[model samples]
Target: MKANKLTTAIGEITTQGYTVIDDFLQPAQLKSVKALLARINGQFLGRNNFEGGKTERIYSLLAYDKVIQDIVEDARIMAICEAFLEDNFLLTTSQSICIHPGETPQPWHADDVFYSIPRPRPMVGLSTVIAIDDFSAENGGTEIVPGSHLWSDEKIGGDYREGDNERDSAFAERMASQSIALEMPAGACVVFAGNTLHRGGENKSNGPRQALSNQYCQPWARTIENFFLSVPRELVREMSPKLHSLLGYSVLSPFMGQVSGSHPLKTLEPGYLPPVSRLKPPC
Candidate 1:
């Protein structure tokens, strides 16, 4: 990635809370993912109401489909996430989002609202929604409220749950007026701060819309998905060290995320024992 591109991505997330980049994936890359998605389509459909009655979702994608590894761990996107969430951030969730025809819009809500942190802190999460199929307003593209990331908690006026689509009539109308559907070509990516208010758009078209979300969060926060258990340990060991760390193999300083007083990765190595250094307190 060029320095200018990194700067621009970070700047967009900083000022507008989001940025859209086309051609994030090569044609070959997109083709592989599309095929994989097709193979497993509808197996995980209608699991949750927030996912729209007509829509379907597939979780633990990295575990099932290896083709997405490069896209999920792309250095360019990681650069933006690292800057936004600071050092030691971790990939929190990765899933396929398939919105079928007649699915309604999800509620307006921020991803980090569950953290319970006081507002005005530097970013705690970052995300990218990668389009597997071209996103169109008629086909359930994502909807986002520009600049909503900068709004104070008080301005939001109340509590929110997942899939809210702005439950308060007044608030919903006000937010809906400003929301814009994300229309982009397949393989495009929309990077955004988790604080930004957004949702999946309604799908009026006859076909389904496909996309994938790769989410990152502050290291100290609990991940939305339990990657440790979901992704097998044997497979995790085969990933790069950076991925090991991102998957939470590395400890969070003074013993956070430790497995028997050592890095979690050790468990994957047969006959491995906890090193004495890890047993000793930090000096």
Candidate 2:
């Protein structure tokens, strides 16, 4: 990706709250990712709901999977993130969301609802949704409201009607609120800010609508999921240095004489530090 293209993508995301990049992943790479996911599914076959049975779907983290990790760190995608968030950024989460056909639509919400920690900065995080299959209105694609990320929380809540209503009324209201359906072909990726108002669409197709959502945030922001605890240190060591760093490593220290344990590995090599010196405490 050229610098100008990367700048344009970041600008669109910052201004509109969402931007779609067509063919973000190569066809061969997308095929390989699909194959790897199929293998994972096979290993857990017969397990109906993998996402803790929270909803009528299967969701799993593929952070330790090399293929998925590589996709998350793809140069094109990184360039876009770099343009918006600068060079240093941490990947908060990388998980697969599978919406099985006939499932009810997910309620409109933001991904940051689970994080109880307060953020010191605004617009410090964003999420990228990579389409594993052709996303169409009939296949349960995501819907979003343009520039809604800048709207007040109360106004966003007020957009929804109180009582149960027919699909026509609901759709009309959504349209009236400036909502847009995100229907894109496979291999494309939709990147949006954390504050973006969006929801999953109803899956009316016969098969599942699969997508890989990779979220990245500033080093200081608390992650929705504890990736370090879920993924082991050994797995982190096996990953590329860049991927390891992106997965919550190599962060800055807040306090003097204290080292933040953000990175999985402590020392780069043996004899790098004085033997008599004690390890610095985290701030």
Candidate 3:
């Protein structure tokens, strides 16, 4: 992306809570992603309503294909994450979401709801959703509340999750009235502040709507996906240094993410073991 466009997109996010990148993926990349999803996406249904029982998600996608790795490290998306988060921010979640027909609209909430920090503050994270299929009003395009990222905790109220209670009907309607169902071609992407209010829309169309979602958070924050456990060490060694950093191999400074008193990357060395693992049992 051109510097001017990048600046403009960041401005939109600052003012409205989200921005769309109309050409984030090429045709070839789109086809490859669809193929990957076809083989893996529907392997399991969401376990709960919050996960959308009617939907399917293939988490840990980066382990399956290089294309996913490419998407996660895309410079354009990284630039946006850089604009919002601090140095050494880590990838929080990487997965594919497929909303099947009859799936209800998800309860409106912010992705950063996990942090328990007051809103109206700088977003602790950033999110990106790339359309894997054409998003339409009738299908399950995401619906976002413009400028909701800046709403205070008092404004969010008790109706929202983070408490896990059912969303209040009146609050749902109010947000519905404010939301815009995101509609874009398959290759486009939308990047938003983690504090923004949004939800998956109901799928009235005959077919399912699919998308790829990646989220990044401040280095000190806990990630939704534990890449260290989910992705094998061998695979991490195969990935690029940028990915190594994103996967928690890098630290926030002198101490965080250290392994056995050294940088986490040291663990990747062949035959390396944690110092504790090498200790003999008390004899």
Identify the leading candidate in terms of lDDT: 3
- What TM-score, computed on C-alpha atoms, does each candidate reach? 0.92, 0.78, 0.97
Q: What are the per-residue Cα lDDT tens digits for candidate 1 across 1-283?
A: 7899889888888898899988799999899999999999867666455666778888878777667777778889888877877566788888899998888887778777778787655567888899999999999899998888888877766444545544577877777788899999999999999999888888999988999998889889998889988998878877877777778887777678988766677777976656764476878
Question: Which candidate, 1 or 3, would have the higher TM-score against the true structure?
Answer: 3
Per TM-score, the best of the predicted structures is: 3
Computed on alpha carbons, the lDDT of every model, listed in order, comes to 0.82, 0.66, 0.90
Question: Over the stretch 1-283, how does candidate 2's per-residue lDDT look in tens digits?
Answer: 7778777788888788888989788888789878866766533322322131222222325554667878878887787666656355778778776666775555565555444333322466788888888888777787777787676545554423321222445643663468677899888999988767676667789987778888887666666667667776667667787776676656645421223432334644434354346667779
Show pairs that collide, candidate 1.
Answer: 107-164, 107-165, 108-165
Ranking, TM-score, top scorer first = 3, 1, 2
Model 3 residue runs over 4 Å out of place are 162-167
Question: Which whole-number lDDT from 0 to 100 does residue 18 have in model 2?
Answer: 86
State which candidate, 1 or 2, has the greater TM-score: 1
What's the ranking of the predictions by lDDT, best on top? 3, 1, 2
Model 3 lDDT tens row, 122-166: 898999989999998899898999999999988877567653334
Residue 109 miss distance in model 1 (angstroms): 1.2
Q: List the residue pairs that clash in candidate 2.
A: none
Score candidate 1 by TM-score against the native. Answer: 0.92
- The per-prediction CA RMSD against the true structure, in angstroms, equals 4.3, 5.9, 1.3
